[model samples]
Target: MKASVTDKLKILADAAKYDVSCASSGSKRNNKNKGLGNATGMGICHSYTEDGRCVSLLKILLTNHCIYDCAYCVSRKSNDIKRVAFTVEEVVDLTINFYRRNYIEGLFLSSGIFKNADYTNERLIRIAKKLRNEHNFNGYIHLKIIPGASPEVMREAGVYADRLSVNLEIPSERSLQKIAPEKDHKSVYTPMNWLKEQIAENREDSRKFRKTPMFAPGGQSTQMVVGATPETDHHILNLSASLYKEQLLKRVYYSGYIPISEDERLPALKQAPLIRENRLYQADWLYRFYGFEVNEIIDETQPNLDLEIDPKLGYALRHLDQFPVDVNRAPYEMILRVPGIGVKTAQLIVKSRKYGRVRYEDIKKMGAAMNRAKYFIEISGRPLPAASAVPERIRHEIIYPAKKAQLTLF
Candidate 1:
């Protein structure tokens, strides 16, 4: 007898738990054609792990079999692990059932290369097409773009998927070769470049048609496994910056490396760098909404992010030339540059400033974390006395005990 759908669900869902690119924000579901599902602007409510972290979607792998032995991957061909692959029907049924139960808002599908890259990508697209065209499912769908997949298949996948991702697992090309000899940077980036161009052209066509067939409205994103390769956070962020600026990605996920397989080819990190990953995410936020460039957050000397201070704080410390920003007088963008301030706090500054000049006390009342913000920001022409009086001393006092050399995001 064949494995039941429940068995497939356990295997595929377990395999997919490690993937973190399932945010459902980029596309809206159109159920005009009696479609079975739809992507709303509000996206879907998050699903959480047993530990209480958000799981969001019913993430799953179509197959665990692999032809390549990537050093860091547990599913490497050489590893002695139970393997499985789902037929297209199995995946489609699983997604619809999960969605009906409210178990997940959608599906995020990926696979280990089966037979060849295009073949794997073709299967992925078939699953989406079956859902969209046959099943008339309108729920959010995210598909992994297999490296070296043909542009035609990539386009098809784009039309079916709300979001697409191609993971750049390591920061540097040299490390990619070292860890996964069968793969190269070119293979990884080829589909990515194609997706970017397709999205641009599709959007332009939408301008003319008012509604060109939806093609990855949520946009494309990629991931990098931190700490597995020699490339520093600076290198990682620079690459991310390029991907965001050039490729126009919606997000870049930073994964901390967990040594799941024994390969001398990989590094010997004691544990995954979750804190470092958190800091990098914070830095990524700065790059997107805070008007920060790669040069501003990292450079040759500071290749790695400061594990103690978050990226916002670290950037403020290094560039005191721009500090003591007046929250009341400075623009909302400048307020976002402060060490401890986030997008929420920055918005509050804008709101309060319009009514009347905001005082230092008004900032605290507006929900600013004043202790950290005070060091890097001023209000109504008065710099925080302690931050200005002893900036470096205060910086060290705040961050010294918290620094860690190794960072990861597992």
Candidate 2:
């Protein structure tokens, strides 16, 4: 007996949960000239806007019938699971109906390799083309480019999709071979390199010719599974940095490996490494926004992040000599390195301090996390009492404030 569309949606959507690279920012497609929808500055998968507007996406997999038996994946071919696929028309109908009803702002579509990479990729491209040309749907579309897919099909995908991604499931080539032997670095990088060039060329062409179509206007992103392999956080972060620098990747998502299968080859984790995943995100943010290098966050001695504290805080604690940054006089870059001072707050401090010295109360008003920042910042040329500058004491106070206060009073 064949399943209905609703049943297929249920199965595939649930199967798609493991994929966490569905953000839809950085695209600016308008519903001009009477299109079905707009994707201007919108985010996907329930991501929020600046004013707290939550945008939702109909995130789903086209199918879960993969051909490869990756040891870490729930949809490995050897696993006995219910298999289903959505016809291209079914997906198109669903997107149009969902858009009319305002159920979703956009679509995020990925798929398990059904037969071969090119075959599966062609089907995905057809769906996007139908949505764009046939229906004039201008909504955000994020498509996952299948590894080993032909460059011709990938170029067609780039023409219609707002964003594209290829998941590097394992962090390193060695681990990738151990878990997913069928895949290799070349298969992944070849498509990624092609997409990067196409995106760049399309931008140049669009500037010269107004009628030129955009290629992955929101840029490309990739995901790496954390804790599944023996790769340290240092290794993962360095890889992320290289992707951002070399491939010009927009984002690198880190999914803490969830133990879905009971394979002896995989780790027997009680739960996903959610904390480490979050810490990596923090470290990544520092790299992208907070002007941090990969080595600065984690080094030879400390390859793993402190799961208890954030990377920024850990960095500040390790380099206490750079602390007590003069909020009234320090450079913008130095102020941004403060553990509790965010980019916005640091900018505000720089702007506000031009007229006069910034006070502790002013720092609080600017939204710096004073609890953490107090020990690291100076106000009115008065640093935190010299006793508080001690790294051990500050760490104790930050980690266990109540205990420290009790000890101080006694």
Give the least accurate 10-residue stretch of model 2, judged by summed lDDT. 46-55
Error at 256, model 2, angstroms: 0.4
After superposition, candidate 2 runs with Cα above 4 Å error: 42-55, 408-410
**Taking the tens digit of each residue's C-alpha lDDT, what string does model 2 give over 1-410?**
99999999999988887777657688989896787998867565545545343447777889999999899888889889999999999999999999888778778899989889999988888999999999999988999998897888988899899999988889999989988989998899999988888888988999999999788999999999999989999999999999999999999999889989898878899998988998999999999998999998999799999998889989998888887798888899999999889999999999998898778888899899888998888877778664275677777678887887798898
Q: Which one is best on TM-score? A: 2
lDDT of 1 by residue, 141-239 (tens): 999987778898888898889999888887888889888888888987888888889999998999999758888988999988888887888788889
TM-score of each: 0.93, 0.95
Clashing pairs in model 2? none
Once fitted onto the true fold, the runs of candidate 1 whose alpha carbons sit more than 4 angstroms away are 400-410
Highest lDDT among the candidates is held by which one?
2
